[model samples]
Target chain A: MNDETLSAVDVRDAVKRYGDFTALKTISLSIKDNEFFTLLGPSGCGKTTLLRMIAGFEDVTEGAIFLYGDEIENLPPHQRPVNTVFQNYALFPQMTILDNVAFGVEMRGNSKAEARRRAGEMLELVQLSQFSSRKPSQLSGGQQQRVALARALAPEPKVLLLDEPLSALDLKLRKAMQLELKHLQRETGITFIFVTHDQEEALTMSDRIAVMSAGELQQLGAPTDIYERPHNMFVADFIGETNLLEVSVDKIAQGRATCHLGGGHELTCNQVDDIGVGAKVHMSIRPERLFMSDIPAEAESLKGTVKENIFAGTDITTIVALAEGPDFIVRTSNSDRGNKRIFEPGTEMYVNMEMGAGRLLVD
Target chain B: MAGGAASGGSATTDTYKDARGWLLMPAWSVLLVLSLAPVFMMLVYSFLTKEFRGGVIWEFSLAAYDQFFFDRGLFGDDPPVIEWTYLTIFWRSIWQAGAATILSLLIGFPTAYYIATRPENVRPVWLFLITIPYWVNLLIRTVSMKFLLRDQGPLNDLLMSTGLISEPIHIINTNLAVQLGLFYSYLPFMVLPIYAAVERYNFALSEAAADLYANKWVTLRRVLLPAVKPGVVAGCILVFVPSLGAFLAPDLLGGAKNFMIGSLIEEQFKGNAGNWPFGAAASMVLLTMVLIILLICARQQSKAGKEV
Candidate 1:
């Protein structure tokens, strides 16, 4: 990496174990300065555990963690230059909003007046200065979340760790605060390591996402890279909705693997490494990537019967069952002109997957 | 039609509320009769004069109050002098109770914290163990302390055998002994409420405080202490009020040196003092003080509740 890409937090072979259970396997990743990095996974996939390790709330059982190139594994939580927005916001219930925001600054040995001034600035940043005198319970969930963010930022820590801060809000409020949080992160230029099990939230806000499963990192890359070019079965399936079709590899040429979808229908996918001819693999194709057509197009296509047609508000999800293969789903956007044709069940349709849309998962 | 329906709905709600209130009257009356009636009786007795033998004269008099404040003149020429004996006893009772409350808190908080931090599966077991003291009668427990602390008791014998002390020390009839007894008796009250608070506490707040660069002590002050304040205050009140008027501990542990308000009332009513009116008067004073403390606590709890 270049000097400009110096790591704000470099987690090296970090492992967390609770007695006989290993919550996080040896995991290594470097979060860049001022980057919005998200640890996205299902619950118990160790995303929160890794975030806690970086926040110094958890001990690294067997590896090191460096913050700004300084080894911080042995440091106590108070000594680390990192803060966490807890899952529940965890605002001091006894204190006013102003006092809650001022707490971190005061803890850093600032005078009460000085801390109040900075805390006021943070509250203003979060657009909560008007509610400074109110207690945390007086505010709504979104308001409390902003206060938590402001409070964590008041100390000006190098890294900010958010543990599902928006999970408590309703869907609409969560969507709105997602953008606000992204904008705040950009304005403050703080490296954010956000943890969430919500993949859509991760895809919406994260600059890069580290997808994890079963205590191991499945993939670490930009959102589009993880979404469009997932490295394995877990990464492909976990990050978004996908249809995993079992296929047999027939040949390899020019970085593409020719695979036989059952019933002699041939399809070629951009091949991942370590799979040779005659190997069984699952071809991961996103539901949105499959195109439905009345007539077979020039690309590789399979004839299947329409199993179910689901009319969602924004998209039409058509599930198709191949004559010799498992069922697959194709999602197409709804058009305003209202001239789109809908295929009923038992109708014969050609399912076309564009070249490079499918990833061969050998795992 | 909407207005009429709305009025009818509200009328039904009003009748329902009235019925609920009427149903609660029996319980309220029971509380008034069982709890307040004795206090009201004591208030009446406090104003009456002591009879020649033992009963009250029913004639309203300030003799009890006068006896509390003034010393009788042994000679005809000398005027009644202001005495500090009863006042000293009263003040001593307050401070000793305060000390016991503080001590109980000091001991209870850590025990509660330890129990709270234990794994969820074992928490109920620890709580059960803490409450095991309640299963034994407090008198037996207090008397057991006498056996453990007497000069030739097991504690002193063990200390002497370990070469920690050369001679047996006297600790049975001192104010310290009374405090120990009170502390032992009321510690559960302190622990249970603090444990309840700690059990409900979101430890994430402490972690957030620490993550904000607060050291351990600062985290305790800013996060843990304030979060558990209601429980601490409750524990203090529970320990303080009863310790202030403690009769058994002072009687059994302190012998005669310690005379709290409880013992003073006991002395006036049935001991050699044999002054029923004076005992009632002292009981009234103690009740007033306790009521004031209770009011302050109620106000504090309400304020804390609102803040939360």
Candidate 2:
């Protein structure tokens, strides 16, 4: 393939405007072949709108989308070579499960025998062949979801768009289907564009994540890169729980900043950009990265009093009040053995950080 | 004492179920007086001997049925012949009712769809417009329709002035005018049920079909029409049953020339040949045809319901 067709989907400066209000401001992204890409954000953040535009349900208001070097922005939804597993499944209530899956194949000019044969194979792939003759209302939600997946995959489109397919499932079923969906994508080797509002699902299933907010892309990278090195405050705060501390830079050297916290506590953390010396900025550190320790570990430690400890199943969380800076939270694995290391309330302790644990968020 | 009071309350609640049989008394009386009694009277009177003017003699006879199937002659003595007059009238009534139902379905489906797809606040206004004409009496509406369809009416005047037609066509006393009156009278029945069904439909199913390579017409045929079929059937029944026995449309609009079943039954009693038994017999046959149609519809619906 040539360079232009190397990527499965290439979106350039795509903008979606609903009347006077802009839903997506000039956004651009590239999805590679066989890659599981996720668009993650809260509701009304334009993630679903972008997915619909790719599926041709929404028109391209400004920019172009190229699929395999072909501009398909003007194509109607039925003419586009893409399919979507809708959020509500949207299975035809009047059709049998087998007929629902065969509908796409028959509409694409296949014979009845051929369509039914191919539909059978797709239903087998989704492990729902036993429900071939049943209506959609007769099946359970999970079974109906599988039927929807089979129907969308029957056409074997170039890209499969999933709009929160597992949002309607229970917690345990959702956890199970997450793995199933990831395995299905890998098995089929089709480019999958999944849209979801769940941060955890995005982190667990997607090879790369695009975090969006307020009609714009906040950050786009691999899950680890997005989690460990957020580009701004919004991405860091939106992705997961993080404690953003107020600190003033004293000096910058070797891509790290020596900053000062209150109560004469000094620390060195990785800096995202050169903000110059003595400038006040916010730095983010994960709660799991900080731990209670006895060693007064030189320049990467802070002194605080233990305020509370909450034991939550597998992990114990401790809230500590620093001498002058914001209160800090520390999480540690729980154990059954008795030990004196766990501190009670009003006990003064030193909180130590691992190397390269905290990074500066530049906005 | 507290336990005794609680038991008393429980006993009162339990006795409510036993007293529930009285709740159906009004319905039972309504069925007996309003429906079953009339039908039973017609069935008995159909087989009785006809008197001279407008009453029946209390004697069991097949003369009414014999008058229907084997017309002796205009006089008293002749070989019996197969009666084509009454049979032709029934067939005409059936054909006209079927055409009116089909016409209403064609126009009603699209109108209901348009009203359903509008914004929620404007939908009631459109429905009000559709039903406003029906608020007038049916007799007045039929008379007004006759005036509009006459040769010198505004419809012909507008058509002649527009040069679409060089002459005023006679329509007021035709079968076409009768069908027009029936369609106008019962169009709301067709539109309302379909509108309700379309309103309850999930549009995401249409979107899903479009996503899976089905265009607009294909989506409507395969997905939408099948889902709203119950409503369509209901609308057809509502329009067809009443149209089968309508007298006003065929009388005022059709000029009393061709006798529909409604007019035929009416002529037996109110016209110069006042045969009450014959009228009652015709009513029984019409009732039987309607019962058969409703039974067929019920069977179709039950069969459809079992698939789901």
Candidate 3:
């Protein structure tokens, strides 16, 4: 790797085991410099384990991790040029906001005056200059979180690890802070590796995301790539709302595969490699990608009875049941064009997916 | 009738507030009468003259206070010479108590840290074990030190048996023995408050410090120590005050040689000395010193509380 574009953090088959239980399996990924990388997963899915390992809080049971092209698996947390904004902020209750921000700078051997001046600048950057002399307990939760961020960033670390830093805030504050954090990351130009279980936050703020489940990496890519083209059943189910149908592949040609849906309905989908012909596969079509019509608009359209219709203000979800298959959900925006043709429960409808909208799962 | 009832209700509410206000009177009155009255009497007695009898005379005099500084000719024609005997005893008492406080803190902090770091399920058991020494009376505990520290006691016997010493060492009637007794008797007082502080502490703050590039020692100095300082101060005061006035340990362990301020006061009051006014003056001085120390500690604690 060139020095100019060397990855900020790289993990080579990193594994974490606690006694007999494995918290994270062999996971290998790299985070680019100046990128907003997110580890998105549910609780106990090894996302936090991976983040702690990168931060030197937990040792790797196997494999190695590198920071800025240097192996740091053996170094302690303090020796590493990395800092963390812990889930609870973990501000020092005894120190004022200015002192808290100056701590890291002082630890790095800066003079007291220099450290204090830098701390002042950081407090101003967080728009908390007036709170410089106030104790952390006196600040609100959002303010404390900003102080935590400023403190972690004051040292100008190579990478900043945030472990669910915004999870403690209310919904309104969380939404506001998410954008603020993204903006801060851009302004600092420092690599940020954030860990969170909220997919919406990840999609909105992350430049790239790694979806993890059961000690395994389900998928790693940009937000739109992971959401629009999930590699398997877990990724497709975890990222967003989707309709998965059990199907068998009939033939594979070029980048598309013809599959036989239930009730012998033959449909073609954009298939990923490694799926052989005549093998059982699950086809994923997002709810918003499926369109409802009164008559057959395409040659391979499938017909079903509308089992239920849900009105959710912005969109109307129509649940359809095939003659011999499970129920499928089709979401249509509540636009004026959509209101012209209303299909209530028990209405007969034909469903057709948009071109290139369906994907065949490899597993 | 409605207006009258409303007025009655207001009167009942006023009575409730008055009752709540006086709720503390019982405890306060007991403390004032039983504890403060004697201290107040001692303050008054310190200014009187010592009679030939065991009691004090009603005549106001500065003889006792003067005698605290001048051994002879306190008010005579000869120049009042300065004396170091009583001052030496006071100094010795202060230094011994300070040593005991430091030793207790050194021993107590690690023990408290150990208990604090124990698994939650087993922490209560450790705390209970630490408090077991308190169940035994302090006098008995202090007296038992003689069995271990005497010339032919178990400690010397063990040393002789190990061939580490040619003869049995005498430690029973020494200042070292007094300090050991004080340390042993008051260890739990030092440990409990520090334990409470450590137990209530959130260790994530230390981790945050470490994440900010601070090593273990730095983290302890900057984070852990400041966080637990209030408990350390409380423990120090608890140990120092009693250790300064410690009479039984020095009386039994040091025989007659140690002669701490506590023993000095005891000698003037009831021993062959029979100097009631002198003893009252010494007691008053000791009380004044302790009060000043307590005021300083309270002020520092309040300052710390405000910052935190």
Candidate 4:
């Protein structure tokens, strides 16, 4: 029996520093074998640094990294079982695609013939077998990206790190590559650690994601958990669109709290931690969960005036302004809008939502 | 009211434009005149007959050109014989310069690479050190090398004191000494061009090569070398051209047996063997040789740059 735990990459309390600047704070995570893990963050949020560290380009100042259950923290990049596809897709400009792909294997003491044969196979895997003799400069952005990916995978690394590999392409191409990469990861069954600032890309391709901010890991969870149940305001605002309304707790009884809005609307929501009656808190409701009504609903509804209306594809988004708080937005299907009629500017509208749809967060 | 139209008339405008164009004629003529005068004078001197009084008489003759190719060294076989000395010196100068250039490129490349990879705040300081020796006179630097290499100098003293040698070595006044001086004098020139080239290096390419399974040496040989060839070639040309024409280092540090073309040309202008016409002919030949080399280097650089 192999008896290995089967997690492809394991990082424990990883930290990186450059003189006085700490580029990566203490981070710990375990990526399951063949799992598509993503590090999502804004620029300079240590996503690229962490990726470099995994690829052996950057040394971990304080941490242990394990690959296939073997400690690889002190290993040099060329000795590590991980390969990185850089953001710029750093394909060797002078060499043809075949030589570029064969380079890693050639370094590993493989004969030229064997390396070329394996490189040819990898090019076929990436659907670019015909471009073997073409230089990287001759290829398009997407083609170059695939070549970079093929080059990294030619060595059959245990983990492949992609540092914003799809960012250089056009929007349409980026979307296509994202899907292609996901399929490629599944086909190869190698753990892929993708780093990007694009939330949509992370949510679409990752099995799990680690969201970082200012060199610190904010939250690490599955994509749905990160989007639907973000731990803090940063994650909530970062992952998707949300409407945060400042409200005061009117009363609390049996795992339920009554929130009083400034616009004279009262609502009952599921109980959140560390809240008392008359204490201020922020209520978060996703735009898709809010609905419009002619009259306020019984349990969780608020009154406001329609400030703006947008006809988005497949949905209508209405921005409603309460008398005392900021503007609130609600998105509903255009078909649903036909029944209740989305209001125009200056029209008084009652916003309705399920009590379970609203989440209260302490200030 | 009619004065505005009269001033803007065709003749007035035509003269106004012509005046601006004509104004630059003298400056342009002066530049052309200044650049062509020495070349024309040198060509005239090359064909003139030499007078015993150390002057040339323009009698329209090729005697000086003929004599320059047949001239002998101050000390050689057959009492300053003609055959083999001139051709031998010509080939030796090129051979020495080429070797020194290759050595300089080898040493300067990695130094430049390291400096280029340094942090922005420290890069300037490292570059400053490379350029500091250049501020001193080249002759002074060449002369100082003798002190560091002479029989009683610290290098020999240390080697002998450490029992690594029984007698002081004969390093100073040898072909090796000339090469050492050539390499040192031209090292900074080589380094700067390479540093400029390497400063633009993208680590992405090496990482890409690594992912493709290239080990360190393979990456350097296949990817990095081609990427930095322009700088390497540029440095080679920078070092080789000047080293070819170097006179002081060979005179001060090299043995009397060592002779470069520059010293040969200089000897004609000085000593009892002063022959200005022969020297002028030789100088013209030397100038042509340098021009040919420079043209070739320029072509090679353009080709390398286009590849990148």
**Top DockQ model:** 1
Which sections of candidate 1 miss by over 4 Å?
A1-5, A335-346, B1-22, B72-80, B162-164, B271-273, B300-308
| Candidate 2 lDDT, B1-308, residue by residue in tens | 99999999999988997888888889999999999998999999999999987889999977777777667743457767878778788999998889999999999999999999999999999999998998899999999998899899989999999999999999987888888888998999999999999999999899999999999999999999998998999999999999999888998898766457888888777955789899999888898999999999999899988864
User: In candidate 3, what are the lDDT values of residues A50-166, reduced to their tens digit?
Assistant: 998988889899999999999999899899999999999999988999999999999999998899999999999999999999999899999999999999999999999999999
- For residues A1-363, write the lDDT of model 4, one tens digit per residue: 245675788889999999999998899888888899999999999999988888888889999898878888887777887888889988878788898888887877899899999999999999999999888889999999999899889888888999999989999999999999999999999999999999999999999999999998888999988887776667888888898878899888999888877767777777877768888878888898888887877757677899998887998889998776678888988777556568779999788886577777754
**Candidate 3 lDDT, tens digit per residue, B2-103?**
999999999999999989869989998999999999999999999999976478899998888898889776778888888799889898898878888889
DockQ of candidate 3 compared with the true complex:
0.62
Write candidate 1's Cα lDDT for B44-138 as tens digits: 88889998556799799888777776787433367878767887888889988998999999999999999999999999999898889889988
> What are the per-candidate TM-scores when only chain A is compared?
0.96, 0.95, 0.96, 0.93
Model 2 chain B poorest 10 in a row by lDDT: B67-76
Q: Once superposed on the true structure, which residue ranges of model 3 sit more than 4 Å away at CA?
A: A1-5, A248-255, A258-267, A277-281, A307-313, A321-324, A335-342, B1-15, B21-26, B37-83, B150-172, B268-277, B305-308
lDDT: the better of candidates 2 and 3: 3
Candidate 3 — what's its lDDT?
Answer: 0.90
As for candidate 3, its clashing pairs are none
Deviation of model 3 at B20, angstroms:
1.8
Question: Which residue pairs of candidate 4 clash?
Answer: A103-B213, A103-B214, A104-B212, A104-B213, A104-B214, B173-B255
Off by over 4 Å in 2: A261-265, A274-280, A335-341, B1-13, B73-80, B269-273
Q: What lDDT tens digits, residue by residue, belong to model 4 across residues B1-308?
A: 68878877967889989898789999888877897787788888888887774777768777766665656543345455464666677777888788889889889989999999999999999999888988999888988898999999999999999999999998988898898889998999899999998888887787766655567887788888888888887888889988887888888888777888778778777866677787788778878887899898788777765543
Which tens-of-lDDT digit does each residue in A177-207 have in candidate 1? 9999999999999999999999999999999
DockQ (C-alpha) of model 2? 0.65
Worst 10 residues of 4 chain A by lDDT: A1-10
Q: Summarize candidate 2's per-residue lDDT along A1-363 as a digit string, tens digits.
A: 576448888899999998999999999998988899999999999999999999998998999998877888999899988889999999999899999999999989899889999999999998988989888999999999999999998989899999999999999999999999999999999899999999999999999999999889999999999998888888888888888887789988998888876666777888656477888877888888887766676547788899999889887888999988789988776762253256888999898887888878765
- Which has the greatest lDDT? 3
